[model samples]
Target chain A: MDMRRLVGRNFARIRREQGLTQEQVEERSGLSQQYLSGLERGQRNPTVVTLFEVAQALGVTPVDLIQPDNVKMPRKS
Target chain B: MDMRRLVGRNFARIRREQGLTQEQVEERSGLSQQYLSGLERGQRNPTVVTLFEVAQALGVTPVDLIQPDNVKMPRKS
Candidate 1:
């Protein structure tokens, strides 16, 4: 599997589902919008800490960011 | 949560459960045993691709390596 693409797709989907913009996520994650954009494009390979920070900012677990499309993660309300 | 430690613990536990050593995992994952040791000690922060490679080498999904302690993953045969 293309893990980077999978992560990017999941991240984009979750962010959109939560009605958040990349700029908003950038502010929350303390990551640059450019970086977020690159990540969404699967152009950035983020470390575990970066992944955790992004997941935290998105109000989700790191697992949620990398889950395969076939597995449905229960959303937090 | 300390994502590094959590990942390390999970990795170590899963590796042990599978009866494999760091050297063996290093051989399979193409990651050095030194690196794997550091990772297992929560001293290394790996990229998502590295995580995927390690998980694949272990014959498990990336989710399995990062699963929270409270979430019991069904073992694959």
Candidate 2:
């Protein structure tokens, strides 16, 4: 279902929006940076709790992660 | 991430709370039953749009899908 792409698309954006690094999210979210990297690359499928953890660490809800945010600044490619 | 188990753990519960079946969710959510089955079984990782579709079909937000519901009815195994 292109789950990786879907999740990856928002992973980094949210991290950045919160001014976080992979390590920071990993530390706060209890998710490994490698896992966060994989999720950012659309290569991982996190569990429900992991989803909640990351969202919570980002100071948002899980819905905030899936739904498009109005912070329209483009990513630095 | 134990994604399959995590996703599967809640997939059916949510569908039941909404009183839907694999087929009904398939049609209404624009997802195939097979895919829905995989999702329910934690064998598939749906895209963001797919996640949105299922959440919309359930008349709940994506947060509703992942967050633990107050509904305490257990599954009939």
Clashing pairs in 1: none
RMSD of each: 4.2, 8.2
Model 1: per-residue lDDT, tens digit, A20-66?
99999999999999999989998888888898999999999999998
Stretch of 10 with least lDDT, candidate 1 chain A:
A64-73
Candidate 2 chain A minimal-lDDT segment of 10 residues = A62-71
On residues B1-77, what C-alpha lDDT tens digit does candidate 1 reach at each position? Answer: 88899889989999998999999999999999999999999888888899999998888888887888876779999
Which has the greatest lDDT?
Answer: 1
Per-residue lDDT of candidate 2, residues B11-49 (tens digit): 788789878888998889788898888888777655445
Native contact recovery (fnat) for each candidate is 0.94, 0.15
